[model samples]
Target: MTTRTPDAEPLLTPAEVATMFRVDPKTVTRWAKAGKLTSIRTLGGHRRYREAEVRALLKGVPSIGGDM
Candidate 1:
């Protein structure tokens, strides 16, 4: 018999997602509520984002090549 451990998935907290997009945490929450981004709630009611989804959004965005 072979035993295997499933790989853990990467999940990003609202704070981390905010930092990635340079937005406020509340903005992330709003996006979640607006269905702009997919999010899962923790047992304690905190929102978490999937890295893959974030990456997809980032890819669609055009680079400005400078600080906003």
Candidate 2:
């Protein structure tokens, strides 16, 4: 089996990000829209987030660009 490196950044789905922050998935979408969080869009138009960014926000640490 292929192994993932511990330092590898994992992508999180909107639902996962929402669950981590204890907010609704729609709220996560709103955050993306408001530029509070950075998002990656799937070809299908679903939003994905970086776990690192999410965790930083959770700790009340703003992103380097101040998007949070």
Against the hidden true structure, what lDDT does model 1 obtain? 0.77
Clashes of each: 0, 0
Q: For candidate 1, lDDT tens digit of each residue in 25-58? A: 9998988877788898877888888897777676
Best by TM-score: 2
TM-scores across all candidates? 0.75, 0.79
Q: Candidate 1: where are CA atoms >4 Å away?
A: 1-5, 61-68
The best candidate in terms of lDDT: 2
Q: Which residue pairs does candidate 2 place in steric collision?
A: none
- Candidate 2 residues 1-68, lDDT tens each? 54779986798999999899999999999988888899998678989899988999999897754654
C-alpha RMSD in Å of predicted model 1 compared with the true structure: 7.4
Q: Model 2 compared with the native: what TM-score?
A: 0.79
